[model samples]
Target: MQYLKRYLLICIAFICILLGIIGIVLPLLPTTPFFILALACFARSSQRFHQQLLNSPYVGPILADWEADKRIDKQRKKQIMLMIVCSFAVSIWLLQAQFHLQLLLIVIMFILLFCIKRIAEK
Candidate 1:
């Protein structure tokens, strides 16, 4: 039903926003994608929630810019790259003797870098 769909979207949005907040302290979980997901869900479910997300201090401008331009600022792209590197470094260092896992992590890092390269820089 329409109400059920709206409720699910709002729930998903809230969960994604929570994950985005947690990603602040946890390096492995990239925050922007989750925040972007939340924004989309909120937009479909509730204008007020969408506006609140748009007004957030740290993420607001980034979300607005992304929605309007589908582009990320140069500094943010660099930061994302740095975060990716640090996350992989930490994961590899912490998972000692897991050769296969380490290799997979390296692959993931490369993929992340490749994706990062594709994002338009402002």
Candidate 2:
């Protein structure tokens, strides 16, 4: 049973790492969260995997900053916010026929903005 759980965790971490890699190139996927998810999973399952994740060039610094300071660079935050807002803009534009959907999108946008604000800037 213990071995099964460990293997499952390894599988999950590998999947998350793959998703993180994909997210790097796909604008809609958001890489950092997947990388962080993999980090968390590997931390519980394998020490070596955790160390390798921390040493990764692209997502390592983000994971380190998030773990140590719970913060991200201000410029990164701005870029994220801009991308989110633009995506919302495109969605809202496309859903113009549905007033309720527009309203829902507006609410979602505000909620996302609030959540983003809660993340400390480095």
Candidate 3:
């Protein structure tokens, strides 16, 4: 049972790492969250994989900082917020939604942005 769980975790970690790599080239698919998940799974299942992930130039620093402090830098936070806003705006504009729904989405996005900004300031 333990072995099975480890195998499953390794598989999921590999898949997430692959997705994170793909997300690097695909603007619509954000990479950080997937990389974070991969790190978690690798930490639990395979030390070799975890070390390799930490050695990755693109993702290593973010993972290291997150692991050490549970915090992201202000610049990264701003970048992430901008990406989220632009993506949401594009989605809202492209969808043929009702005015009220669009307004609601904008409001939600504003709230999220505000929260993220507050966190980043800290």
* Winning candidate number (lDDT): 1
Root-mean-square deviation of each candidate, in angstroms?
A: 1.5, 2.9, 3.5
Position 44, candidate 3: lDDT: 95
Q: For model 2, how does the per-residue alpha-carbon lDDT over 7-105 read when each residue is reduced to its tens digit?
A: 899899999888878865554455677888888888889989998999888778778888787788999888878877887788788889999998888
Per-model tally of clashing residue pairs: 0, 0, 0
Q: How accurate is candidate 2 locally (lDDT)?
A: 0.82
In model 3, which regions exceed 4 Å deviation?
18-30, 96-122
Whole-model Cα lDDT per candidate?
A: 0.90, 0.82, 0.80
Per-candidate TM-score against the hidden true structure: 0.89, 0.72, 0.71
Using TM-score as the yardstick, the better of models 1 and 2 is: 1
What would the C-alpha RMSD of candidate 1 be, to one decimal place? 1.5
Check candidate 3 and list the clashing pairs. none
Q: Model 2 segments beyond 4 Å from truth? A: 14-31, 55-57
Clashes of 1: 0
Native-to-model Cα distance after best TM-score fit, residue 99 in candidate 1, in Å: 1.2
